[model samples]
Target: MGRNVRKRRSPLAVRAIAASAALAIGGGGLVWANFYASAHEENSSPNTTKAATAQVATISCPDVGQKLTNVPNKARGEVDGELATLDQQITAAYQRLATTRDAQTRDASFVQNAILGPLKNNRSVIIDRIKLEISRVGGNAPSSLDGLSSCTGTPASQTNAGWGNNGQNNGGQNNGGTASPAPSPSASASAGGQQGGGQQTGNGGQAGNGPLAADFVDITKVQANVPRKARTRAGGSTGTFTTSCGVNANKKFNTDNVIVAPGVSNGAHHLHDYVGNQSNDAFANNDTFAAAKTTCANQGDKSTYYWPVVRIQNGTQDFDQNNDGGGKEGNVGQIQQVKQAQIKFVGSAKSQVVAMPKFLRIITGDAKTTTNGLANANAHWSCTGFENKVQLTQQYPICPRGSTVVRTFAFQSCWDGVNIDSANHRTHVAFADAQGNCGNGFKAIPQLTMRLVYGFRAPTLQNGQIKNAYAVDGFPEQLHKAATDHDDFINVFDDNLMNKMVNCINKGQRCK
Candidate 1:
């Protein structure tokens, strides 16, 4: 269902206010030192000048929503609205930053004085509202929230660089850090492309935001790196339950996130491809979900499953080419239809899983991992044939001829056995440890692993430019980094089907 549209400021007026220090900002690249240093130092060395003048790529703000873990149930609705407002503030600020590049070049303190300062003040006010909402509901608001109001600039260089495994294991899968023989110099030369730039360029596809050539790697060069298998316990549930939900062939798409920003239009700031439950939108509640029609083969499995839509940036524009959360927000190109979507639920390696509570909301992977760091990043990118041998966390794999691109999401399986959702939308669900063991007080639930395959021509790197680049839709500030890939799920299975799924998993028998 289409979302209820909310009134928005005129784009021109919003930009004017943003340029005049009235709007809050998010996204990266606005280093004060680099601007001041480059403007004043004429005698600096070539390298010094280059380093000192690197462009601000996007805005980076402390994720305030992630820090709020204790808001009372009664206060959650108000707090969620405020959090969405904060996101809006950042988006506006980033819009200012993106539009005022010339002004920033002319005035060294333009970003600090007009954008970041106003953004901090705006965020501080929003945080205060959150605190007040909690306090009104007899909840103790954490004092540390005040510290999250400030924002920073991420340099263009940092955003384009490949991210390494920051040592966190992702649901017992490969951490994406295994070493292999280096590519030959000639091979490296051919694969290597220009770094991301500030302004729109042929190399940095979507409105100069990205899907940079450097963001891709030749999959054949990666070594076999899947980790050693951890032994399953004697009584471990060893089977799987598969659900056949056709890919979004009906083109079900939206930018609203009902789980995190309910009732807010275009809250995700990116397009999402939805399967199962056809009635998902920001206004959807438990009753709406229960009554919705499903695309799954079994009518009992009405759970909503969605992820960011992947696009091929081959100079083609989609229907949303001129609308918010699409081309207007730097997410351009034609949306690729998924060739196959495999949804499987498997039991734990340690014990049998209990049934997940109906309406349980689970979000796997961090959608802002580029700026938020790798603490919660769970992206897995690979080619069809190389899935077992190599999985990439940061780089998009350049598959060989006849092989398609694949994205996998292994969702959190350990539930806290309490609330259906949490204040931050993540605390109620947890991923099993590397040994597939659920933590104390947490019960194992069916682990959903969604494997989506796309049949598109692999983008080529030639003459230092990308030919048919593709990337997941994301917040404009995230620049389409691979690590920002994520998936969302809400359980709405009919009781009988859910029970059947749990039993199928625990009995170690494959069922469809």
Candidate 2:
């Protein structure tokens, strides 16, 4: 099994998601506006006037549209149905956005967003037009059932007398010879301007003016309605791994933990959260992993432990390597390639190594094996200036501070007995056996994910254990030179638990 890593976004990426979400809401409003304009235009025409009369020909039609529910009812269902359909269209737009990461593959998504954003947001625009027409219908009704109010030829019953209001007398005072009297405020709000086959005054606000009462859609509610469309982003924090344990001949852990600056420095940290806050931190990389091997071995368990690495396939978001090109965004395919390389490094492992939740040991194709596919040589050791060497630190009663001293590591030093850098040389540096040189700096950080799970003891035997451990000397050089194979590995962790981990990171708990 593999651990799920939340991808982090650059500030620009965060803005992009916000912008997209805003557009989704805006799209819905536009649809409603279009409908309102069309309705108003139709009402102005002679044919529409007749149709409007037919629609309300019967005074017996119950005044059914009351109380605002998200759903539409029979009396108002036709217009409401159109709004519902518009909601569907907006939902579809979000779905497309979740699936696509870049602008080019998202034509349908863009179209949907652009179309629906304004309509759903402009409900007031709709109400205004409807109110204008409602004013024509008058507010009060006759006490007796009327034949003209019913959609069917028969007269409506007393129960629906409210629908029979002819508005001739009970309606407001007729403005000096105007065709119809103005509607009352309550009537304008509820009935929306339909009385006596006449047009009504504007509702809520003037035409083509003012904001809608329901402009802000409940985003959380929308999320519930469409769970699959939720966005997943990466954590912004970087991880640091600084064990100097003579593993890999005094080289730091072979993993690469990219520090995003201004983040915590626990070594080899992986990004975990993406949607809400875009942040990152560091984690311990080399401690408990090798220790788990020894601890399990002494207990006669054959399980092996290692760290997990990942390549985040950030679906349409752009990428910037070293923040180059002033934050230029790349396409989805290019981002996928970066993610694939990370996966390849994390999933490769020895036969008996069962991947731990957050940690995993990997075996690359370029790894040399003596026989039966055991790790012959690791990529970490080959990158030294000279040949390659691997060495484990002396068994430690306690994990040391800062980088591990090679003398205390479990593996022998892989150093080739040559100092690569005289300025920053240290006694604990391990030399490569093949190249006779100390490992370069790349291997200094342990695998970021594994560092997260260090010291995590399995609660049961069903979970795998670490049997043996090794650190290669020349990681960066050897890692790239080795053959590469890609695996579509499915790795996941419980989101709830992962969330706890995220919280821990935020609170400065490197690995809990």
Candidate 3:
């Protein structure tokens, strides 16, 4: 069990590479600094100061990410389909184990019951079917699940004290009034300024002269009378079911500070928090999950909700470099912790509702994405009413005055009615329309809509100097130029609570 308990660390190069992006949080959002990849010469002399210099970058999975192509349609429908489903389930369990390992108590029980158990069952079924279908067909089957595309944890130990202190130099721009002219969103992403050492960087941090650039767009730009966009409607024969869950705002960020890698190893690559579900983190259990009081308006609901811990990135706040205990007072970065998630549920109107299965898991965006390019970035940034308009240029958005800063999350609501989940953690359910309505042939569950509202705080003044603080903590230094920031939801709901919620959806009642 302790074979992989070692604390993993990111290389000085990777962290240096990520931190090089001095995201211009002010007007125009990102002001990405360039990381120059060091050239490796064959005759280069061995140096004792390797950690301080050029090092080969380490990728998390050298054997994963294989997609079956050109297979016979029969195998595709029979073997490949089952394999894909198993892959999704495995990834979900992996994510749970990863998060659970990082959870406050390192709840091995939940890892066993909620995560590993289901993973084994699903994988076993998949392997048996794959063997039969492949033997029957004339083509080769994938040799292993390792070749599957995955959405679990990265070997964060592949990171380092966040790229390097080069961000400190980029931080100089904040102090200097001659900050480079905020470039057009199009031009801000080129080599971005250069990193001091030979290190490559990702896409994020651009210059914006406007008073509002930030990674997460706040509602500051919100007009008093700006109308909310109506939720998408399919406009079919089915009537829609709705659930407007209140924001458990003011919830506490528990002691779960560090992110664990695939095997549930103690990892320091990024940080996160757990709330709402009292049984979150490593200590999570069905009993605790069922017993834990919820902030949702529904009394008996219990679900483990977690996301990267938010940090006030004033003056290069380090990741939660330290902790007290019990997941309390653990902010080593001296940042503000976000307290709540504003939630809304969208469901299909025509189909009968069904109870949400226990242990349903989904990750909405990729937090481990590199800062390499913007086209593939999914940082999902936008402001209130402007949600449809994604700003890939700015890591964050400066809200218009009078509007609230909002981070939104929408989960797939359509269920396949059989498998509670799929290999992608998404295939089993489908989204309705852009307006949050569901389609036919699937039972409507609450269309999970979550918005995080924040009042941006300027960098804090500390030690006679203003510290540059980020709104969230422990993100991949690059933020994948776009999809670096994301959110997670785990259905740890009590059976009774889930059934009641299901009933509400089936009855087409306005539920809270």
Candidate 4:
């Protein structure tokens, strides 16, 4: 794979494209697809209408911007040392992300867990250190170095530049030196700016005033959903070869729920529905989870069902839970539903759709909570009676014969070809092929397809969670889990991504 250094861009725009560009490399196979971010030009545009991320992510440090000129020389040295070390660690992480061979390590999750998490912890430690210093010598504690968490990627050159414009110049710059790896004969580096010279200071990498990206997860290339290998009866490209379940008849609601995307809040930081025992929190709790009511027909089967909570926005521009927040993005109109989903085995697409991996967690939407949350395009719709075709609209198909009402939601199964989990539930997993096959450089774990077959009558308020309401088991604050809501799936069978879940998807056979 070729590597190129890109100029720092807006966090939202960069993440939107990176998340979209992640390619699915399944078992020695590379699913080919064009990856491009329209926001590339907007990154440097001084005249664009786009609102700079600075306006959105105002990471404020307490107003301690005082003239350290009068502070004791010893105190200044101590503060400088602490700041330099912390900056180096954070910079190194971005450097590693920019050049890590293991695709799994090059994301926001890795940045958080392996990089930012530790970096932030260090920040806490320094705050304590600063307090002690101030206690020893009566003076204000410094907080100017508190804004390193947010940033768009920058070249290693700029990152290693001299000491940043902090209140004190303690001498020496802790440069992470995050530059692109050696390019292949075909793969080049630094397409736009001076390639060798890291002189251009952007973001915190340089001491200049460039704002850091709010998000660091590499959302560059969303994997490919190449058409299923087995064509429809026509045996032609025009034919459809997809599957579906559930009678999802309408786009009911789209309110921010607490469950759907956990950890990093999606702007509003709402919760989402999570089935199984594996909740997407930062820590990996016990895999064995308590059981709950399921919509599936098979009794005793307690697989998890996760989705965004929906609410009926009251037309009144006014605001309330029952009524969708008028003019709000999380309102019903903003909800993005899953477009294509299926349950297939964990092998090559040429083979039969087998069982899924046990304890596999698949997140559908971008949990970053940006306005373009649905840009990832993980949503795919289809019906149960018809395996040869797929549907995009909420309009459910009338079942002929004894076919079931299945709402199919296929989650990304392509691991960095490595890690099972990442900071952002997604960076570790990319969507597999329509047939559940992953592309090259990616290992194919058991791809999970949630065929939410709904034989029961649709609730007046169709919440997708345990009850007809949008709230989870304990949280009574939600209004309803209706149609306009979103859906996410997690397998709590085990710790591994591939295991017994394979047997669950009885390829071609109508399963419960």
lDDT of 2 by residue, 1-512 (tens): 21112233344543343344443321111111111111352232110101111111011112111112212112122223222222222333333322232341324334335433343343333333333333344422222212211111111112122221111111111001111122232322222211112232111111111011111111112211101211212421222212111111111121212111111221111111111101112222223222332211122221222222211111112233222110111101111111111111111011111112332222211111111111222222111111112211110111223222111011212222232211111121232222222244312211122111122111111111111111111111011111111111111223443344334433334432
lDDT of 1 by residue, 291-332 (tens): 999999999999999999998876667999888788877788
Task: Return the lDDT, model 2, position 304.
Answer: 26
Q: What is the lDDT of residue 232 in candidate 3?
A: 33
> Which ranges in model 2 have alpha carbons more than 4 Å from their true place?
1-427, 432-512
Weakest lDDT window of 10 consecutive positions for candidate 2: 480-489
* Number of the predicted model whose TM-score against the real structure is largest: 1
As for lDDT, the candidate ahead, 1 or 4, is 1
lDDT of 3: 0.37
lDDT of each: 0.73, 0.20, 0.37, 0.29
Please write out the lDDT profile of model 4 over residues 1-512, one tens digit for every residue. Answer: 11111122333542342233232000010001011111232232121111111101111111111212233433543443333223223222323333332343234344335433443454455456645665577776444434422223222232212312111111111011111222121111111110012222111111111112210101112122123343322211121122222222233222232222121122122333333333233222223232333333333334455554322111111232233221211122122233332433333343333233334445553322111112342332223544444332112233334553344445554666444344224455665554434456665444455554434222121111111111111011111111112455544333222222343332332232
Q: After best superposition, candidate 1 residue 17: deviation in angstroms?
A: 12
Highest lDDT, which number? 1
Relative to the unseen true structure, what is the C-alpha lDDT of residue 319 in candidate 3, on a scale of 0 to 100?
37
Error of 3 at 192 (Å): 5.9
TM-score, cand. 2 vs. native = 0.15
Candidate 4 local distance difference test against the native: 0.29
* Model 3 spans > 4 angstroms off: 1-268, 283-288, 291-297, 316-319, 322-334, 349-352, 369-380, 384-394, 433-442, 458-477, 480-482, 506-508
- Write down the TM-score for model 4: 0.35
For residues 248-338, could you state the per-residue lDDT of candidate 3 as single tens digits? 3544454331111221212223455555665454334344455676655565556656665554422223433443221112222343444
Off by over 4 Å in 4: 1-268, 271-284, 287-300, 314-348, 352-357, 367-375, 380-408, 416-418, 433-437, 450-486, 494-509
Residue 498 lDDT in model 4?
24
